[model samples]
Structure formats: C-alpha cells, structure tokens
Target chain A: MSRSARSFAVAGAVLLAFTGLASADAVKLGRPALPEEIKAWDIDVRPDGLGLPEGQGSVSQGEELFQNNCAACHGEFGEGVGRWPVLAGGQGTLTSERPEKTIGSFWPDTSTVFDYVHRAMPFGAAQTLQPDEVYAIVAYLLYLNDVVPDDYVLTKENFPTVALPNRPNFYDDDRETTEKAFWKATPCMKDCKPKVEITSHAAVLDVTPDAGKEGDKPAGAVE
Target chain B: MNQMKPGSRVDRRRFLTLAGLAGACAAVGVQPAAAEATPDPDIVNLPPWTQALGAGVNNHPYGVPSPFEKDVVRREVTWLTASSESSVSFTPLYALDGIITPNGLCFVRHHGGEAEIDPTRHRFMIHGLVDKPLVFTMEDIKRMPGRTNRVYFLECAANSGMEWRGAQLNGCQYTHGMIHNVVYTGVPLRAFLEAAGVKPKGKWVLAEGADASAMTRSIPLEKAMDDCLVAWAMNGEALRPEQGYPLRLVVPGWEGNMWIKWLRRIEVGDQPWGQREETSKYTDLLADGRSRRFTFIMDAKSVVTSPSPQAPLHARGPNVISGVAWSGRGTVTRVDVTLDGGKNWTTARIEGPALPRSMTRFYLDVDWNGEELLLQSRAMDDTGYVQPTKAELRAVRGVNSIYHNNGIQTWLVRSNGEAENVEVS
Candidate 1:
C-alpha cells in the first residue's frame, strides 16, 4: 500500500478505537432532573407575589388566627413583641429620626410575608400550618400593614394585587458606582492617614488590646 | 517536635490503626463496642454523614449543618426578638479547630432562611444620606479593587451568652462556642462609604440583605471607615451559599450579627435604626432593669481544645496539650494554662504566628500523672487585658445577660484520660 493509504488506515483505526471507548465508558445511571422536580425545589415566593401557590385566605380569618397563634410572640396587631420583627406600622419613617423595619413600612414585598409563614414560622414547628392558614396569616399581615381592609381576601387569584410601600425604595444596588468612585481611586499609599488619627480609642472603642496584655510573660519563657 | 519512646509510638500506631478501622466499621453500619455503650456521657459523638440520605441529589447544592451540629446552631428562644422569620444561630466555636470551620460545621444566624438569591440577578443599592444614590450589580463588585486577609474569629455578641449566670450547657460548644475564624477577601467598606461620599450629617450606615427577611442593621460610619471589610470570599474561596455566598459584611472584633450576609443594600443614616436584632435579641439584660445595648466587641478568651470535652487525652504519659487562643480586640499576647485548676498557671508557649484578630495556637509541655486534675486557660490580649474568671464576669454583669461571656473555662481531666466541662469558682 502507498504511504498515504497506510496513514488513512491508521487514522480510521484510531477513530474507531476512541468511539468504542466512549460508548463503553458511557454510564447513564442518574436521570436528568425533570422540570417538575426543579420547579418543586425552586418554589420560593418573592415579596412581589412571584411564585405564590394557588389558594385564598380572608382577613377576618387571618385576624382571628393571628390573635391566637401569633399575637403572644408577634404581639397584638403585629406590632412585634420584645425584639421580634415588627409586622405593622413604620409608615413614612424611612426619613424619620429613627427608622424601624416593620412589615408595612420596610418590607418590599407582600409575597414575602406569605412565603415566610408558609415555609417556616412559629419558631420550633416550622411548616405545620395548612395552606389556607398561611393565606389567612398573610391576609392578617396585610390588614396589619393597612394595605388592605380587614375583609379583603388574600388568595393566589388576587395575591399579586397587593403592593408594598418600600418596593420603590429598594432599587437594585449598583456596585459600579463604588468601583468607579472608590475602588479605582488611587490608594493613599504615600500619606495614608499619617498615624491612623485616633479619633476615639475609648475603652468601649478600644478595639485593639486592652494594654500590657501582649507578650506579658517573660519573652524567653517559652523556650 | 519532641520525640517519645518506642512503647508510646507503638501504642499510638495501634491506637490510630484501630481508630481508623473503627471509623470504617462505623461507616459501614458495624457499630463499635464503645458506640453501643451509652456514648461517653461527656463526649459528643457526631453521627455518620452517610446515614441521612433522605430526599437525595440537588436537594441542597450545599447541605445544611450536620444533624450533630443542629444543637450547635443559632436559635431564638423568643420571637419579637426579630420579625416573624428573621433569626440567628450561634457557631459552635468550642467544638472546632485548625482555624477552618468545615462548611457543614459553620453556624448560621439569619433574619430569614438561606436567601435564595441568584448572583446573576442580585444587586447592591447605596442610598440615603449620601451625595449620590447608586446601584451596582454583582459584576460591578468583581470589577472593584479588593484585598484579602486571613483574619480569624468573627464572633456573635451572644456567644457564650448562656453562660453569663451559671453554666447552662455542659460543654464549651455551648458556652463559648459562637465564634469562627477564617480568611476573608473583600473590598473595604471604607472604599464603598468613601465612594458614596457620605453627607457630613451621615453618622451611621445601614446594611441590608436580600432574603425574605430583608434583614438590615445600622453601623457607625466612623467604624465603617476605620477597619470594616465588605467580604466576598471565605477561606480563599467564594462564600458558601449559607454564608452569604456572593458577598457579606465583615466587622472584625465586633459581633457577627452586624456582618450581614447576602448583602443587598447600604443606607447611610444619622443614627442606629434600633432594629429588632439590636434592641430585642442582641442586647444584654441587667438586674438593674436597664438593658445593655451596643455591647459590640468580643472580649479576649482562650480554651484548651485537646484535653477538651470532645477531644479527650489518649495517652497518660507526657501529654502535649494544645489549644487555640484569640481576642477580637487584638493579638493574643499570652495564654496561661492551669493544670491544677487556678492554683498554678504556667505560661503556654504560643507556637504559630500571632496575628491580630486571628487564632493563635499554644501548647503546654507537661507530664500526665494519670490523676484527676483540672485544666483551664486564661488569655491575655495585646492590651494587657487578662480574661476574667467566671466570678469576675458574673460580678461585672449580672447573670441575667445572654451575651459576651469571656470567662476562663475549666476542664476536669479524669484518671482515664477523659475530660469534662467544669466550673472553677
């Protein structure tokens, strides 16, 4: 055979060997995740009513249930007990002397109130409440926020209708501004705050060592 | 390294080989002889990882803390301490070692469960009390100049808070367990605060997370400019999904609560927002009716990890006891180990490089008498502040508090080479 013909034969043999190896190594053991499986795991409801399950709850039912199950910890009217999260009223306080994170004033999504309750709530026993009970709680939360009347019903059909006050306040953060303005700024490598000006090293502020505590034992003691 | 005798080496080899086989047998469901006997009362044995394979793959790209570590998690005994879903978990710092807390071992405290945030869609917004209100995408953060430092020990204020009065939990994992040390990489918070051009009136800055809880906290602007780091990496890799993944707040020496995870927003403000986390949950209660708030920095502390409850002494002869010592305030100057309780304290030899806000390993060379003895450690920070005794701690702050208890810990060593949690009053 001619040299060219021999080379072609060698290449063909190599290809056949690799193809056989590939087929031999193929192990189709685990099945690919189906869309339904993916959907089930990814079922997270956003505050804006994204991904809410199909169901409905009335504010009155929510009010009665919230009083019994949630009031002890969350307080009556969702004001929040002790240091628990505030569920109602921080309206227009974003600019106030002291702002609070309340369900009505700070939360950017109504769907979040529903999602959190449905998945994990009541401290120890999470996800025990029925779907309607979750809806009633969400409705009660809405009533506390004054977003809807006490009689308004919260369900999958009308869940997306309710809006949050802080929705506009929560604009997507743009770190680019930081990059251009600060990260790219030439570091003060030369005159970097000469001496680290001690504005306040108060005992409460003394984040460093207390004093004389470092290397207290004789230096050569370890050896 | 100090060399020992042939007899000891043989014992060690046999012990390690047997230990390995026992571990293997346990993995395959052959319970060891010791396992059947009520697991050592003092020693907590972690369950095998392969046992709980419920609802398999892609169930959690990253798994939750081990069921063994469940009790070591952060919990809110009361609600209203945070809004309905917002909460926190304590790190079992006392049960970990070598400075890297396994991802499965790290504690989690959250205003909400792990925020299902997609880095592709996530954005960070800076507004309020700033000359300009701007927004940045996750890509923008990557483009920014960042630095990495291997700092150690970021603790929650509530670490060991339970032990303020008397020892509530029997082990160090419960008492002084709410801290973790790791290398962090991030753009300095100062870089961002300076970029925002804080209005002169701006005094405090609030950071918010993107989870269902939408957690937020206000930090003093001065502190932000001083040494705060806006971290994106932990232990040289991207933050774990549970640990804020793409980005988190790093306030060295301060409580972990302020280090918001899955950070999305920072709003400069004139004063603290007095959020529920700060007022209701983190604050320490005093007998005087007034609560102690803003008790931020963790005090100096040290503990003997080897002869500790979980890790008991194996051989009785000359034992090289080792442990980790750290201070949120600064470098550990010295760690004194007391083998005979508080009666005599010999200065422990710090072995590794002692960096500020980092874990410093210390070792004590002492012969084991095969007798019951009390082992304790006291840490002295660079500032000459010695870790207080349990009594001193209870004296300064009444027992009603549930945070920042940095008292000296005692471990009772029995003749059999086992250790137990103890109190030295």
Candidate 2:
C-alpha cells in the first residue's frame, strides 16, 4: 500500500465506522502482518509449547548468567532480596500463612518462567537478552526451584514435558455462582443493623501523606 | 492572560470563587452583565489584565491547565511503594466534580515504569493462530476500521487494598484514587483480531506491553471479543505519556493492570498463559489456601467524596453530599446514602442517565444540625450486585492478598465539621 493510499484506507478505519463486523471475514484496512515482525516480537511461550521459539540452553550456562545478572535483586539463591521477587524454592507452602509464591512454588507452568524472564527479566533492562540466555536462565530457575536436575538442558522440543507441581490447583473464576447471595435488587434500606460501632480509624494507621502545592513535589511522583 | 503567578499566595476560597466565575463565563458565553455590579472587598481586585490586552492565541502550541487551578493535580501516597518510577499518584478526587476525571488529573499507576516510547518506531503485532498475521503502525492502527468511543473505568485491582485489614488512608484519593473513568476512542480488539482472522483453536489472547515490566496478561477470547479496545486516544485526545501514549489496550471494566500500557503485541492461543502477573502477582489467595485466578470484574462500589478526610465540611446548614458510583457488570441502578451510618438511609438522586461499566454522579442533600454523623454510601448495579461492607468482604476473602478490595467506604464527621477515614461495625 502507498503512503497516501494507506492514509486513505486508515481514514476509513476511523472511530465512527466501527459498528464493525461480528466475525473475521477481513476488511483489508491495515497491511498483512509480516513474518519478520512477528518473529521479532511473538515472544510469548504457552504451556502447550505453541509459541516457544527454536532454542536450546544448558543449566550450567544459566547458572553463570543468573549469578552475574539476577542474584542482586532475586538473591544468590533466588530467595529474593529486600522486597524484590523470590524466584526459587517455597515448595509445599501454598497453605501457609505467608505462602512464598515463587516461580517454582506456586506457578503452574514452566512456560511462564521462560516467557517472563525473556520479555521482562533483569528488572530495569528487559528484552536485552538473547534467546539462549533466556532459555539458560529458565533452566537455572528450574534447578533453583527443584523443577529439574542440574544437568537439565531445556529446548523448545522438550518444553511441554516439564510442568509445575501446582498446575492443577487453579480454577476458573466462579464469582457468579459462588457469590450469588451478594446480589440484591432491593437491598436493605434502613435499620438493617441493630447497632454500629467504630472498628478502625486511618489516623491510627499513620500512613497518609500531607498534601502540598505542585512543584513542592514532582508531578506523577509518589512518596 | 490575567493569570496568577505561580507560588503567589491566593486564598483557596478566593481561588474557588474566581475559578467558578471563569467556568461560569465559559459555560454561559461570557455575559458582561453577569459580572458583579460592584466588586466585593474580599474578592481580589481586577489587576493589569483588565487594563491591558493579554497575549494573543497560539501562545502555547499545546495548552495546559489554568495557572490558578495548579493545585488540582494527581498526588502521591509516599509510603505506598519503594520508588516513584514503579509507584502510584492519586487523582484530586475531592477537588473534582461529576463523573469524568480530567485527563491531566487522572490517577497514574505503573508497574515497572513508563516506557518512553517513540511512536514512529512503535507497532502492534498480532500473530499465533490466525489466517493473516498482521502488524499495525500508529497510523495503521488509527486508520483501521471499526473505531469505537466507549466510556469505562480503569481501576487498579488494589484501589482500596489499604483498607482490606482496616481503614488506613485519610483521603478518598488515597483509598480510591487508583481508578479513573475515561471515554476511550480506539479500534475494537475484536476488529483487529477478526481482521487477522482467528483460527478455531484461539481461545485466549495475551496482551503485552513495551515498558520495562513488559506487563502481560492472558485475556479470555470471550472478553477480547466482547468490549476490549486497542485504544490510542483518551477523552478525545492522544493518550498522556503516563497513560501509554501512542497505543494501549483498554480492557473495559477489568482490573487496570490488564489494560496494558505501551501495548506491543497480542498473541492468540488455545489456553491461558498463566504468566507471572496472573499467577504470582494478581491472583487472590483465599482462606482455604486455594487461590482465585482471573477475578477480572470489579464489583459495584461507591464512596462519598465531599465529606472525605481531605474534603471537610466548611460551614453548617444545607450542604450537598456528592460522590461517584460505578459497576463493572452493568449500570448503577441505585446509590443509597446514610447520614447516621447504617441506622438511616436515603436514595441519592442519580445526576444523569447512568451508563454501564462507567461512573455515575450521585447527590444527596441534608440539613446540618451540627451533630456528629457517619457518612457512608452503598451502590447497587443492574446485575443486582449490592456493594459489600468491609466486614462482609473480609469474611469471604481473607486479608492475605491486597487486590480486589471493593468494600463500602465510611467517613466519620464530627460536629466540628472535620471528616476522618473510619470503619463502622
């Protein structure tokens, strides 16, 4: 599509014309999505191995990468630094008062570990790692969380074989069925309760901030 | 421009009056007769601007809020997060009126940080199970057919998370500022997905961001087809930088975090991805140790803004108690206000026609006898979902997790006319 022609086609794509089709018959507005562009992004990995890229990495390589890049915030053992996320152990702790929901402990899929590390790992500097580096990191995370042995070398071929122990623990949202009693067309209006008493006060929590003029503090700034 | 200089000390009452006058002028088409016949001694006297002509138009290629209204802005709850980049800023809810939160003053909440994106270099790619894989440039997205303008609220799942255990935030902004309502103008997600032609196996869609967090979430195909939008503009203008600038996903009525900012990619698949965000972060941990995943819909909720901790009653006698009520399931059918807490209640008048999955302005007037009162509001939606109390909410889902705390809020007003955040049982 030519530049001006593309603009004209897009002009038709404007907001008002969108009582759009109910199905995918295609309307030829934007150009066909290219394979190279999809390949550059298309980085998501699903539990069924549908989106995993062709790559292979060893746990040994991942250990070196993990120690150099991840240990600072995630802890040397993926136990997590001050408030950063913990990536390793916490097996069998889901029911505990403070469950450690690390990648291995509570995550239901290994593909999630790969997808997350590849796209958003190394904290501030994301999407800067190579495919093999991400795969290696995933391997090392598995070794840390006891999902795989130290000798395990992950590849796209064997990706679906590994699964987290807590995979079956999840269930789809059932709010409609579970919370039916909460619905009331005509709610209780007055004197519904015998008496009401103060249970808590925010002033006692001592967490609210003092409001000041703008430029007294930065915009879009939180304390 | 007869603008007050920045940092100049002007009485708040005086500013409010001036702003109200300016607003009235703008609304009523500047009738000279409406000006006060005689300037009151208390009001600021007309300055040099009345004597000399102000700067001509186009002084600002892009305009900004009036200098006199500078104080109306998003504020930060300093102790909420570790750093400013990955933190939140609350809207000046008390200062705002009606349902639409101004574009500049809308609350901001980011995960990793704002991705300073360059539009020319940015594009949205849709792949996976599709007939024709496609990528859209900023212009391409704008040109796409089936553009829609829908109004909805984007609420952080943790909007009232601080109050899960007990009342902790002093202001309505802090407790509920994590939500904002806007009319999003964009192409429907279904249009884009259908343009690419979905394969029969595609059951879920993963929307990904371009920020440092590269925030991603698995949205069900049913929702992707229902009302989701691939939005570029908000409230009729280009999106603000803090609001994902050039392009962002608008998952109406869902938790705000799923409205991925700086949206980059959408991949269709057969099953839920269970990414770190869904599994590790956004999931709710229940009392029985089982966790509830994909709790997307924000339940019906309401809050009294005028008598909040930050917005205290100024004088005794007749005062209109006003606030906003909204629901994710459908339109807000009713909002009941209680002056003496749960003991007595009155149905507040809905200001206008209520819309589904959007904010509704509500008002209730009461005569002040100067007695102590507990101000509370209860909202019910078309789905018959009545807003739950804090005690009712806590009983079902323990305070183990912070997200999805949509409980009815309470404000205690003393005879002195000051209000404080409090919980009543």
Pick by lDDT: which candidate is best? 2
B186-295 per-residue lDDT for model 2 (tens digits): 98899888888899999999999888888889999999999999999999999998999889999878888899999988999888887877877777767766778899
Predicted complex 1: DockQ: 0.03
Q: Which sections of candidate 1 miss by over 4 Å?
A: A1-65, A72-223, B1-96
Predicted complexes: DockQ each = 0.03, 0.40
Interface RMS deviation of candidate 1 = 19.4
lDDT of candidate 2 over A82-174, digit per residue (tens): 556678888877766556777777788898888888888777888888888988989999989888899999998888999888777777677
RMSD of each: 17.5, 9.5
| B49-138: candidate 1 lDDT, tens digit per residue | 545656778778965755665554443332113443444444555455565666545666665667667788876766667765556667
Which residue pairs show collisions in model 2?
A: A10-B143, A13-B143, A13-B144, A13-B145, A18-B146, A33-B134, A223-B78
Q: Estimate the TM-score of every prediction.
A: 0.58, 0.85
The deviation in Å at residue B168 for candidate 2 is: 1.4
- Give residue A170's error in model 2 in angstroms: 1.7
lDDT of all predictions, in order shown?
Answer: 0.63, 0.80
